[model samples]
Target: MRISRLAPEVATSRLIARTSGLLTVMGGLGAIALVLGSAGAMHPGAAALGPVTAGVGLVVMRWGHRIPLSGYRFLMAAGVVDIGVFAYASPTVGAAVAMLSLSAFAAMGSFLFFALPCALGYLAELLVMGAVVVVARGDVDAGVAGVLAVLVVGCAGAMAVVAHRAATAHEDALTGLVNRRGFDEALEAAVRATARTGEPLSAALFDLDHFKAVNDSRGHAAGDEMLRAVAATWTPLLPGTAVLARHGGDEFALLLPGSDGGSALACAEALRAALPHIGTSVGVAELAPGDSPADLMRRADAALYRVKSRGRGRSELDAGGQSPMARDLAAALAAGTSGGLSVHLQPVVTPADGEIVGVEALVRWTHPELGAVPPADFVPVAEREGLIGALGAFVWLAACRDARTLSEATGRSLFLTVNVSGLELDDPGFPDRVLATLAGSGWPAERTVVEVTESLVEAESTRSVHALHVLREHGLRVAIDDFGTGYSALSRLDTLPTDFLKLDNSFVSAITTSTRRARLLRSVMALADALDLILIAEGVETPEQARALASLGCPLAQGYLYGRPRPVAELVASLTAADVVDPPAVALASG
Candidate 1:
């Protein structure tokens, strides 16, 4: 109920300031109108009230950006006084009635800017103010007062509903923590406070590691409890000056005032240590000179991606100078079209024949300063920095280029496979973009296969799954990658619109030594066979593993044994022994 407790939201502050300025103009115009009329002849007292109303308007106009949210109460009180004088400033009943109706702005502002209790308290003040104007002014009738009451109460009631929805919008229902909307507001307020006080401000983003597996394995109910448990565990550990918010799914955001990089890192470590069982990856960043909230968060996110790529369950702090080379890698990828970002093709082949049936397009980024930034590193950066779409687009473009070159050199079109994140599917225009890329590259959809992780299919997201269906309808084949590594709902397997299933390396790596894993792989292969789906075994490093796979009837496979992912030049060199290397971006394996 106490708005003072809520973060001094920037949007809320701006709304109040703008509305106050508008109210001042409204009151000032009414006062000027009365001054231009015959108020001096009718009600001599009304002539004096004109100047009184104008004075209030001048005071209201002065309460601008400099005024803090705490001063909002004073603003509402001043508006009440201004309205009363404005009604009496005019001698005519119609003019007085119009001025009285404008009082609803005050009531509406109260609800829009404060909690229900605070707004209701202001409404009561308005009711009393109206009654006083009716009793004190004999010229103004009770009917005018009644109309004013209806207008104010009606508008205030409507705003109350709106405010309630807004309150909920700022909170996460499951965790009872502030949502992304609230986190952003808190961050802005903290930034402003830091600017004024010259105090340290730090922010961190927390991503729960491997959280999807929990959702798929234990059900959504268990996943929800994990989220709530995280909130409950972390809230008590936070300082009173700190704000923690849920950033959707298993991710969270935190803001800490008076904490620099070192302290923020320490705080993040403590929180991570306190977790029950889940591992978390944290990215911490402190406010830098001339840095906005977004800049600070972006740096933190970059640091976060680095931590995730290395391995989760650790905290990485982005000191102002941290990873400057990879800070905006996605943008660099965009600019590095000729040299920085490229597609490396890894061959997917039939195990028995050792023939390269197709090439899997893997992205590689070479930062000018940080040359050869691995896909694992830059891929997360693209996703975190909102450059994933561009990255995906670039991969398609590069793959098309290589596919054309290889087809010319080898004399046939090989089915090309490219990896896509589930996040890409959320885009409504994803299919269009894919089609456009293929059409532009002159690559046939029939020869292109987009590989998505099994975890993506397992999630059962309507948008993502539907996007897969759309891709299939457009003649693009879909392959579920990292197959034994997900929370596989076997029942849903038959229903999935897929052309191939790629066995995960985790199971493949142990398949030769572990009989159980080998049996499991066989079962998956048979399952794929029953569904008329082609099965591809991945990560075949040893000759024995290759023999084992072939013996067990693996239709297709790829790995280091087939010669590692290499560039087009390397592929050409492998076939014929002339030492050659690509300028950038090519990695393909042999069958």
Candidate 2:
């Protein structure tokens, strides 16, 4: 039973136990001194017992550090021992000595227990001390017992206040869930328990899909209300052993003791079912053989990134196979610092005349052993490992330089589109960084288009919105890439500062196969026209798809039909061979 209850004590309880231990030790020693001083030579047994009890109390205080919860009980036991010793030694010593010992109990009781329990314990101690005083028939002040009672109550009240403050410190003020600090403490404790018991432990990280949009569109107050509603709804659904915490912003973390990956995923699905309107991406990772809290969290975060990358409203379990990739990526990034990463460009053209008007920059990584690691595999790894920022900056700088060179060589104003990570778009300094890169590369902002995934529209925070506006103010164009593949609504296109919408390849793939989908494509084109935004169709893999896109009045298109992603030299050479001396100005006249 003791082992079962040996889970880590909360921060508040630990603080109280430590304070109680110190108070207990002080109370024990003070009792001994008062008795010795008042008695003017204590009884041999009393002198031996007093110091021995005090010494034992000090030892217990030290032991509390290892098992804080158990230590709390030990401190309580020490208090009981002190009272018994004082009761026994009171007759030989004066009643004043007994009263002093009772006062010591009052101080220790303050932090020893909660208000009701502490009050009851102190009241019982007072009764024993009062009886001792009556039996001793020594000149004890009649008012001392009442004064000590009041002191005990006051101390207990103070302890309550301290405990409340400690709890508040660890709680999220808005959501009433554990804050990040509390989550860390709880995760450490959970990891230790899993290590000791060899039980499966899992961590889940949840990100609310498009949460920033909620804050941006409905106002922050409504966002706060939504967060609180989520917490209140989901808190009751968690198991008793699970720890739910707000992990800053629109994310929440769950620590599930004795649960494996499968169970954790189930919990996530259950949460999704409960809050159907509020989409969440959940990542689950079970504890490994030698996993620390940080390792577990990193894995879970990686899994969450995968979920978000694939599409937001789902749960994913970490395969725990990224250690090699993580290592290689770290090494690659280190090497990339001295010029290892490179960019390739894919031409975006008008299907009507196949004229190259813009180029989309794609990052490439050629590993030493792994050869060319695909962006799909390493890009998410970079985002998870905090290397995305550096990698993105490198890509932006290289793309701008290459685009500038290509335009100079062609003597034309060919636009360059660079894919920006959601992290980069959300960064406040991203607009400034783009401007700095453009300044260094001599690439005009008007010739640069920042391409972001459709998720950007959903996760549009105020800062991100402001950043987009700032980028546009500096004459940089913004386009939503992979449009139909994410949670973007056609009606909401005007809400974002988007100049172009690139239809996802999935939709393009369906355009030729499904008549219903072809109609949807036409509607999308009409909506883009209505919104006065440029529409671009991606993955026009065949003449048929391109012909269909043209018939649908889609003005811009990019796919293998034009050309695959190639090195800048090859792309420029191909464009030059196609007689592209200047940016093409062909307009589609027919479907």
Candidate 3:
């Protein structure tokens, strides 16, 4: 809650919380010994000191929880104290207890940050006690001693199983790809490594094209089948050893290690060509060393939107096939040029009213040589390289700057919504960052929308929901972007903090061809109405598509029909010139 609760401090808090429960039990034992000894019910010697020592452990655990930022360290300290208490109270019993404790420690090893150290401490304690026992008894048995060792090792094995199960609980039941938390962790790790080594890493963020339409026409079973099919298709095409994670619902990411912008692009292209029936919009970015996972994802996602803009089922490389200026921009990003990037906004309009109610802020990189590089090419790299936090901060500043300028120029309270990476939501500093940025920019909080996807909400914790609530508390609105693209349960929708639903474009694209898709759209509209949430239909390419979406009660629309994303000056000019313009002579333009 305090400013000091940032990064390293929070890491400390996590350390303590994890081990506090175990310490509580030990502390109670020590307290009991102290009580009995004082009351003359137990000997005033080391042998009668176990319960009192345990009580002391409980105090440490209690303190650990309160500290909030030193959880891991506190827990490790607790383990050390346990060893000391046991040694003083009763050496023989302490050795046996150490073996039992060691097992529990091993079981929680994977989840605990200090597992190895805790295990070693326990082992050390056991060895010391073992020596003490041999000296006191002068006898070593072949059967009983072996049995004791086996029991201790067995306890450690049991603990390992417990930790493994705990880790797996958050995994996607169908694809074995890292779920939301897992993906966040993997991305964060990549970012940190890239920063440390200055190696280019990338993230490919994509979703199945026309996936919802498949579900609507074939049934939920078929939709699930399609997802599994796509995952199967991509399994091999991904670089032989990359961190591929299912990012909740339909979205998946392939984290490339030591990959350059070009290599990452090649990987995206291969993935795009592998799918036979379904297509995907692939966004790729070369992670800048020192970037946060959130920042990297934002860049990757921005690149993906460029692909979506170019038309789905395609891949956009941050460096390839760009104008000279664009290429220069890519080069500058690779060289770690500061102030080389900026943000642009694409309007989401009401098909019926044609009023610019909201705009999605997209980031763009302007390398000194390349001019302007699309976000898709660089965002993935940022997420993988752990620069996502910096990327998010940059986007926040740009979006706020544009929102203010738009309001001032148009005399309209334009709502500016920005897409956020899942990793951003998991950062404890995210909510605070949002509040501070908004305050600094003097932007109206209600006029700002934070767009998130269903996959992220589903993969993340109740904390994601809580974070959204916190954003709302600070007056910012939240929208579920790319809806119908992920397998979000109805119950989840009921619980998550969402003010709007931005329906995925694929469903809108298929409305004219599939009755099932139309029906699904109708149902979504109905649900939105029931929930009193605004519905923004994306990818409205044709007039017919626009009409169909409006007829189905989708109040807002975005896509080529409205306008392609452009620079601020161009966007302002287009807004001034908007009219009930005739649709393009043709309805559907194939990519």
Candidate 4:
């Protein structure tokens, strides 16, 4: 609560209060020892003080949290009085030298709890008090002074080593800013602290816009220098309440307690102006009501992505509530994954035998007031409102968990396909998150497939492509969804990592009547064969379309003809033991 630059290192008030309690008890015990050794030279009042001090210590220890600022000043003041009493009353140089041990505890307490300056001042007070006592003894105990000096200097040195290790462990060596671990701790603390005070807490993420280019062109050393320079330039300009950390390579995180979104943006602009050389993309978001630290960071990070997508070298604040519906939907997802939001399952079938091979997980939200909100309406709201990542994560977790149940409930093994947004795909961590969901839900990675829109794959953002590759590398399959709808060069198919291609519904809807469309479907089947990719025909609504797909030797397809999207429970319940569903769509698929 000191609001110093080393606020992170400050000892909590409870810790200081408890330390004070312990020291007071020790001081009382020492008084008892002096009385016992003095052979009736000490007064009875001094004897009575021992029990009183010990009792007070117990109270202080028990009620430490109630003390102001957790008792930093209280402990410091107590240490001063304690040393003064010991120094003023020491009868001999030997006694004075022995009293320096008490100084060591106080020194360690001060140095460990307070910042460098305050810790050093406390250490100096102890030494000066001990020196005065040593001189007042009227006997040259140069040895005692030497011992006192060692005790003080040694405590300070030990503290220095400890402080260095603590800083290095949490500090980024390159930029001398807080590391990810430190930032996480501070952010969590700020969230709790702001919640208690009802003060605003804003979080922001910063990334060097062209950092990769700088690293590639100028070498890593220059990149390191640039990062260091940026840190150095901005470090002093930041307020004590603000914490700046290196979130990861070329990225930074900042926490500003007591600042709202607007104030955070102003501070961000100042930081942007400070960075003379390279441009940055920054996202800022304030702590919304009922927000956890993770939620705040996601909103900020999402805004950062939005900035990069629009055009970099700018800052964007997740100005919460892009619309009333968006706000309500975001809250619904946060309230509980199962409360109003759920993942529905639509079968992806094998056309030749009309057997269900897998299911595509579709996210559906049934609002409490609005009934079933269409994905078409809500998904855009999620993207625009920076809730897509949260929405995507929820779907992945819920779908994977449900997919396991789908397999268990039906006595069938099925692969799970979950669609991803372009914004989600663009994130480098998206694949790892998906892998986490599978692992956490006890689902096999080999049986999982990630569906990305064909339009997204066609654009070919390097980050998005890399994310898909990462997924495939971990035994997860990638599918180019709604194929033939997006403008992708056929040549790209050779290099793009893919395992399945679902024909766009438009292509399937017309394939029954249009010879040209049927011929194109045949060509697509051949292309799938050449690429070793499976083809799933989408929107097989009629028996004629199903037979046409089977005639063309298309391996798999999914649509209302197979089954409409349903809850995993209902979908599994409607299926027979052989994985055949009792539906007209299933009959239609059987040819």
Clashing pairs in 2: 551-591
Alpha carbon lDDT of each predicted model: 0.75, 0.74, 0.64, 0.78
Model 4, runs deviating above 4 Å: 3-7, 40-88, 91-94, 117-125, 128-132, 138-148, 210-223, 273-279, 309-313, 321-343, 349-355, 366-371, 382-413, 421-443, 453-474, 480-591
Candidate 1's residue-wise lDDT over 327-426, tens digit each? 5564566576665777777877667756676788887776677678777777655665545677787788889878877766765447899899755775
Candidate 2 C-alpha error for residue 522, in Å = 14
TM-score per prediction, in order, is 0.71, 0.65, 0.45, 0.74
- Model 1 alpha-carbon drift over 4 Å, by segment: 1-11, 39-63, 69-72, 85-98, 182-199, 207-226, 269-283, 287-337, 344-347, 351-356, 362-393, 404-411, 419-446, 450-533, 537-553, 557-591
lDDT of 2 by residue, 1-591 (tens): 112111123234445445555665676676667665664554567556567656765765666556644555555655555565565555543534453445545443544344445445655655565556545655555665556556655665565556456546768999989898989988998898788899999999988888877877899998899899889999999999888999888889999999999999999899989998899899899888777897788778767766876668999988764467766776766676343478998888877777788889999988777788899998877776546777888899889988988887777667888998876665567899999999998998877888888776655545567788898898888888888875554556767788888888888888888999999988888877777778888988988998888777788999989889888888768667777456555322111
- Model 1 clashing residue pairs (backbone): 344-586, 344-587, 345-587, 345-588, 346-588, 347-589, 565-588, 566-587, 566-588, 567-586
lDDT of 2 at 304: 77
Instruction: Say which candidate scores most in lDDT.
Output: 4
Task: Write candidate 3's Cα lDDT for 1-591 as tens digits.
Answer: 111211212223334443544544544454444444343332345443455445545664566446543454444455545444443343244343433344334233322333444544655555455445534544445455556556655665565455446556546778765677767776776676677777778878876765655765889898787777777787877666487777866678778978887888887787777875677878887766445676567667656655654456788754423344434444544454275776677877877756676678888777555566567867755554445677788789778877788667665556788999766775667999988899999897867888997666555443466788899887787888888876643557776777888888989989989999999999988888788677788888998998887677677789988777766777766665663333221100110
- Candidate whose TM-score is highest: 4
Candidate 3 displacement at residue 78 in angstroms? 30
Which is better, 1 or 2, measured by TM-score? Answer: 1
Report the number of backbone clashes for model 2.
Answer: 1
Tens-digit per-residue lDDT, 1-591, candidate 4 = 432234345455566567667877786676556645654343455355556666777787788657674355566656556665654565544454555566777777666666778778877787787777667765736876787789777986797668656646788888888899989988988888887899989989998886766876899999999999889888898998899999888888999999999999999989998986689889999999888897888788778877776667899999774588987887898787656998999988888767776888999999889999999999978986778988999999989988899888866667888999888987778888888888899998888888887666554555777888888888888888888875653657887778888788999899888999999889988888877788788888999999998898887888898899999878877884455543222221111
